[model samples]
Target: MKVRDFMIKDVLTVNQNAPLSEVLQLFVAKRINGAPVVDADGKLTGMVSDGDILRYINPTRQTVYDMFSYVFVSPPEELAEALAYKVETPAKKIMKKNVQSVSPEQDLEEALGILAKHHFKKLPVVNEKKEVVGVISRGDLLKQIAGRLNELNAKTVSR
Candidate 1:
């Protein structure tokens, strides 16, 4: 099967300049974990996930040493400051630019290999112009496999 066969056609995307807070709200309202970031021309530029947002909003750690004793902690004020700054930042700042994507004509096994190697939850399906056409998640592939297996089983039983 091809990636186009099982990919989700109704893809959700965000603009590169979109505020991080807006993206986060979209994730919650849409109940989506991630989305591809697009350019003004509607071309895929990067990807953003809830994990990325969390990591960005997380405070940096600091280490202190006093006569051979060391202590590490993240200050509450620093975390609060980061949260404030991050909310106003643009999505492009935190989005993953090195996106792993598949072509619509690519084989399902190849897409699966990329997903497995990268440990990605979803892979964007892009065209030659680098525009996102669809998205394929592991669940989608599993569903297709299960449906195919059931069809084969039914055929075998009848014969």
Candidate 2:
């Protein structure tokens, strides 16, 4: 099967100019961990995930390296205070600009390779115009495999 065969056609997408809060709300409402960011013409531009938002809003603590060991220190309260403004910031400011995508016609094995190699949970499927046509997730692939297995078992039992 190809990516287009099992990909989710009703994909959730976000606009580049959408606010971070709006993106978070969408994630909660749709119960998705990530979404592809699209342009006004519905062209895929970037991707934003819950992990990305978390990294931005709650930055990791600073690590100070000593001669013998590393000392981890918490971020200054001021830094946390500063990040509060990010909620209203545009999604483009925090979205991952280097997005990896696959064509709808691409083979499922090819998509699987990319996902496994990159440790990605989902991949955006694009058309020739570079517009997002659908999205395929690890769950989708698993479901397809399960269905095929069931079919094979049924066929064997009928023989």
Candidate 3:
């Protein structure tokens, strides 16, 4: 099977310059975990995932001084300020720049190899111009496999 066979054509994307807050809202509203980050020309520049957002919003860690045996904690106000700044930051700041994507004409196994190697849930399907045309996910591949299995089983039973 090819990626285009099961790829989702209606891909949802986010602009690189969009605020992290807006990306978070889009994630919630769309009930999606991540999206492709595109430039003004709709070129695939990066990918932003919920994991990236969570890491961005994570509060500053406490520091410990071994020699002085002193522990320094980040104040609530400082944490709040950091969060405020992070929310206003653009998605590009937190997005993974080196994105692994597949082409629509690529074989399913090739996409699966990329996904497995990267431990990614989904991959953006891009054209020759690196413009995102669709998206393929592990779930999509699984569904296709299941459908094929069912068809095979039906054929065997009929025989």
Better of 2 and 3 by TM-score: 3
Name model 1 segments beyond 4 Å from true: 62-74, 78-81
TM-score of each: 0.86, 0.85, 0.88
Residue 23 displacement (Å), model 2:
0.4
Candidate 1 C-alpha lDDT tens digits along 9-93: 9999999999998999999999999999999988999999999999888886765545556665544458778787778899999
Q: Tell me, what's the RMSD of every candidate?
A: 3.4, 4.4, 2.8
Which pairs clash in model 3?
Answer: none
Ranking by lDDT: 1, 3, 2
Instruction: Write model 2 residue lDDT over 21-107, tens digit each, in one string.
Output: 899999998899998999998999998989989888874455565655766666544555746777888888888998889998889
TM-score of 1: 0.86
lDDT of each: 0.91, 0.88, 0.90
Q: Which ranges in model 3 have alpha carbons more than 4 Å from their true place?
A: 64-81
- Backbone clash pairs for candidate 2 read none
| Per-residue lDDT of model 3, residues 11-46, tens digit only | 999999999889999999999998999999999999
